[model samples]
Target chain A: MDFNIFLETSISIAIAACISCMIKICTVTLNMKSKLDSDYFILKNKLILAKKENSILVNKVVLCNEINSKLLQSFFEVVKQLLSLQKFIFEKGQ
Target chain B: MKKKLLSFAFLFLTSFCFSQDHSKIIDSLKTVIFKKPSDSIKIKAYGDLCWYYRTESIDSAFKYGNLALKLSKETSNQVGEAQAYNDIGILHYNLADYKKALKYYDASLKIRSVLKDTMGIAALYSKIGLIHQNTFKLDSAIFYATKALKIYEEKNHTRYIAYIKSNIANIYRGLKQYQKALETHLEIADVNKSINDNLGLTRTYNNIANAYLFLKDTVQSEAYYLKSIDLALKYNYKKELAGLYNNYGGILHDMKKYLEAIDYNTKSLKLREELKDSYGITSTSLHLAGLYLDLGDFNKARNYLYEGLNLSKSFNINELKMDAYDKLASYYAFKRIPDSVLYYRQLFKSINDTIYNSRITKEIAEVQEKYNSAEREKEIQTQRAEIAEKELKLNRKNTQIIGLVTLALLLFLLGYLLYNQQKLRNKQLQKESELRQALVEIETHNKLQEQRLRISRDLHDNIGAQLTFIISSIENLQYGFKITNNKLKGKLTDISAFTKETINELRDTIWAMNKNEITLEDLQARISNFIDKANISASNSNFRFNMDEALSKELVFTSVRGMNIYRIIQEAVNNAIKYADASNIEIHIKKKYEAVVFTISDNGIGFDINEIEAGNGLSNMKKRANDMDATIIYKSQIRKGTKIILSV
Candidate 1:
């Protein structure tokens, strides 16, 4: 009879421990899941902002490339006019 | 005349032998009975005392038998209960209470039969046979005795077989089947010898002696009676001896040895009185009364007659009572008293007639009982059939109702299913529309992002080509002209260098933009490339990058985190070379628990953390660490090395 009680107590204690572990694991999983969910939203927002910044940088680079190309075109024209003037100076000097 | 008394108290002989051997067994049994706490032991002890006192004390015997029987029933010891019933039956048999004896024997037989105690059942059969024999039911006696003998024979129970045969012989002798009686007694004697049962032999010898004396074989009768008497005396079987003496007296009276017969009869009477056997005493009393009447001893005749008559009346020994009455009528007639003779004669006839009438009434009552029970059985069977028919009708109605309910349930279920299906379909259609709209939105976003990447790649290609073409044109102009103009060459070199720097910056931006995720290996390769360039600029300084093998090569980070860590490393390295003027700089990456640790150390003129000014390099590193959810700590002294530890 004493052995029976001990066996019953041991079995109940094991079951309680197992259930408590399950509860604890469920609680931990919920906590981690919520934390990860919030992190995902925050990261998602950051990704949108970075994508906008990337688009702005892309636009700026494209505009700068166009402006630089025009500037180069103007410099080439000035260089052509300078070369003609240099020829004129030589002809006058001669 | 044949001595019609059964005298078959073989069971009592065996029980009394044990009891007589230990005269104080009753007292000891009583003492032990009171001492023991267990009901079973007490029950057994009480049963023992009950049988022990069967011939010793009538009231004590019944008291113990009742105690044993009640305790056995209370304890539910069926074997003990059957034994107690048998013991009580024997007590009744000894008291000449045949009805009560048969009742107890029937009770014992029922229990023993249920228990399947073969020996006990057979013993009850034999005992019941004795009761039937004593009651002049010779056919029933023969039937029961044969049943007992068959069982004993099947079991190879020789001693019990002898006991049963002795009963059968007595039964046969009473029925006056003398030839059959003599044969059965001879078989009983042989069975007794084979089993070596002395008490059985004593009873068998007496039976044989009676059979011989009745057959007119006085020589054989006298010889067999002496044989029985010899064994009875030798074994100290006082019960068997009393019976033997009674039979021996009857034989001697048949031989006209009246004086010798009286002596044996008186001895038998004294022994029966000592044994407290009411039947035996009454039988001997009547026999002695006849012997005295024969001897013309009227005083003794009258005394013995009254003694036997009173005892037979009290014990309900009707046959013996009638014998007493008949002998009393003879006595009165011999005394020349016609009034007394007539009175006793009437008494004798009435008792005889009552015995006959009671037998007839009992048989009629039994037949009536059997017929009434048969009618009751038939009536019960009819009622059961009616109940079954009603149940069948009710079941049919119940089944129809159940079928209707099931049909209604099925119809309701079918309707509910259609309603639920319609609801589910509408909800599904709505969800599908929303999913399709979301897919279209996501596809549009993907297309825009892809366009942006394509445009960025095209811009980088254009700008990179332009910068390279301009650098090459300036180099060609300087070399082809062989220009010794130092100012113009210096200006051209500066323009080329600036354009090269822009190209490198563009490449770095594109590298960071294209990747969604970066690993430590990727960062390490980028950092090593920057360090190589720094080494070329500062050849006197030593640069080291160390990564522990313990750190997993698969360590990954989001693009933002990767860009932040790379920028932090670059800013730290540049600050060390330009400001700290470090001779040796080490970039070490290692694993710490679950986190990765990066240590950028410079063995240069270190500045104290508290005294150092808050610069863009240090603040940028702190901001990057905070962005990545990492902690940064700067350890430095004025003269010691400066270390920046970042844990992620």
Candidate 2:
């Protein structure tokens, strides 16, 4: 009788272990899926930020270059007038 | 007119005086500049020439700078224009025309400031300051120098700071503020010492020597000059060496060591010639000429002075022209050529009046204001970069916080699931243990039930055998002795009959106890055996037992209920046999509505059931029917058959 009880206990434990393993497998699969979803969302957000930064940098560069272009234009205008004046001075001196 | 045309030719071929390969490059550029259909390329070629000739030949550098500037304006190439102006300014500065140098420098400074080119603006500030210092405009020089200093300080450009500081020190020396000049030079020397900038250190030493010389500290001046010379030679700072030799020669001249001064000036001139520093050659030649004049060598003196004059005229350098004119006027006077002396004197005065205009000071002030605004713009850019970096860090921190929270929640959920699983496992174990206990209790009850049946069977068997023996011994005594007493014999016979009945009751108990259940067939078989014995004992009457076809097979009953049903049938049969005087007796068994029906009838004279008291046999049969939960009926008539029916 004791042996029978031991055998029954062993079988029960085996069955319980199988059930536990199945539950563990389900939990693990759910955890993995959740982790993947979390990581995917985080990465997607990071990609968006990177794209935003890239666009911002490009805009800033364009703006800077545009301003420089305008500045250079004004500077050259002044230089042209100065050169013409110098030419008149040289001609008068001759 | 011939001199102007010759100067133009020399400016165009300045590369020829430098590297032969560079001359080829310049030739190609000149061809491209004239022939290329693209105005942009023409401008670039012009700019290239200006850059190549800036150091080698000042007049060529000026011509190219002007050409590039003109083409850049035609093409609207602002970068080329800015570069051309800067190059032209440097060329004129080298040519010793401080007024023209400041004009070109301001133009370049305006463009660079508008472009927010911080380094370029700072460099232009230094150049403009140098021009002002050259013209002896001390206050205007300090303003531009300080403007450049602020920009370099904001940019943290250490090397450029030291260079600008050296220039400021030179300006201080020109102001005769010896204390301020020495302090600025020391500051520059400390920076150079920290960064190991040997070239900057050599220049600082030279400035310190000049400062000491102006203060009349000859010992300190000579020691610093030697230090400057030693470093310049070791590092091969040829440009600094040339300037140092000229300055040292001036000190020698002040000391009235005319031969030594001439030797140093000649050495300086040789180095300038080797370096192709046309401005240095002109200035040093003028110095050598004056030294020879002081020493009474008129032929050598005129040779040096005229060479200096011709070179200065070719380059259009006003500073060198002024010095050459002064020396020539003195020489011509010494030689008694009054007409040449008056012409050179008038020329010097005309150039001086042209260079000293205050419009130049106003322009320098305007350029300084432009640089200040550009500096503010650069500061805004730095602030924007810092804000962007902070935002990026904040974004990273937010992501880290979200990741950590997700991890913590996941861990919590995992822990909850594990805890639930453990609880379920413990509950299942408890249920299994309870099931095991129930099975043990059931097994124990089954064993006790089996023991009870065995004891009942043993008691029934032993009691039945003893009762049978008593009946048989009573019969044997009655037959063998032949007793004559009727009452005693009758009583003995009654006792034997009682023992036989007791034996039958014991057998029924044993049968019911030995089996958990008894079949209707066993009850039927026992009834038939009693009928057979009754026929043998009472041969005068006939008895017949009949059963229905449904009762041919065994009908099941519980052991206790079967015994009760059998006893009821046996009593009915016995009562019919003893009380009825009939020729025939019949007992019939049938199944009716799931109950067993038994009928016993005798063909004989019978007493009325209502007239007689209830007999022990009849009452016992009713009691046994009640025990079996069955029904019994009896009917009899005078000279008619009697019948009893039992249904269970």
Q: Candidate 1 on B1-648: residue-level lDDT in tens?
A: 111111222233335556455457776666665555467667777887887777678798899999999999998999889999999999888877788889999999999889999988988888888888877778888999999999999998878877887787787789788889999899878878887888888888888888988899989999999999999899888888899889889988877888999999999999999999888999999999999999999999999999999999888788899999999999999999999999999998899889889989878886799788998998999999999988986886675566556555655655565555556556655655555555555556656766766765676676577677877887788778985657555666666666666666556555766665678889889989999998998887899999999988879876666777777788888888988889999999999999989889998889978877888889979987897799999988887878988888
In model 1, pairs of residues that clash are none
DockQ of 2: 0.00
**TM-score, one value per model:** 0.50, 0.40
lDDT of 2 at B176: 77
Interface RMSD for all numbered candidates: 13.8, 56.3
Candidate 2 per-residue C-alpha lDDT over B1-648 given as tens digits, one digit per residue, 9 for 90 to 100: 544544445445554534455557677667655544366556666777887765456578778889889988887887788888988888777767677778888898888878888889889998888888877777878898899999999999999899988888898788778989999898999999999999999999999998999889877888888899899999777778999989889888888899888888888888888767888998899999999888889899999999998998897777788888888889888889999899889877777766554356656766787787788788888889999988977876675555556555655666666666566555545554555454455445445544544444454455455556656766787888886667557656666665555555555555555555567787788778878888887788898988988665568766656666777767766666777777798888898887788888888878788888987888978887786677888888877978888888
CAPRI-style class, candidate 1 = incorrect
TM-score of chain A of 2: 0.57
lDDT of each: 0.79, 0.74
Q: TM-score winner among the candidates?
A: 1
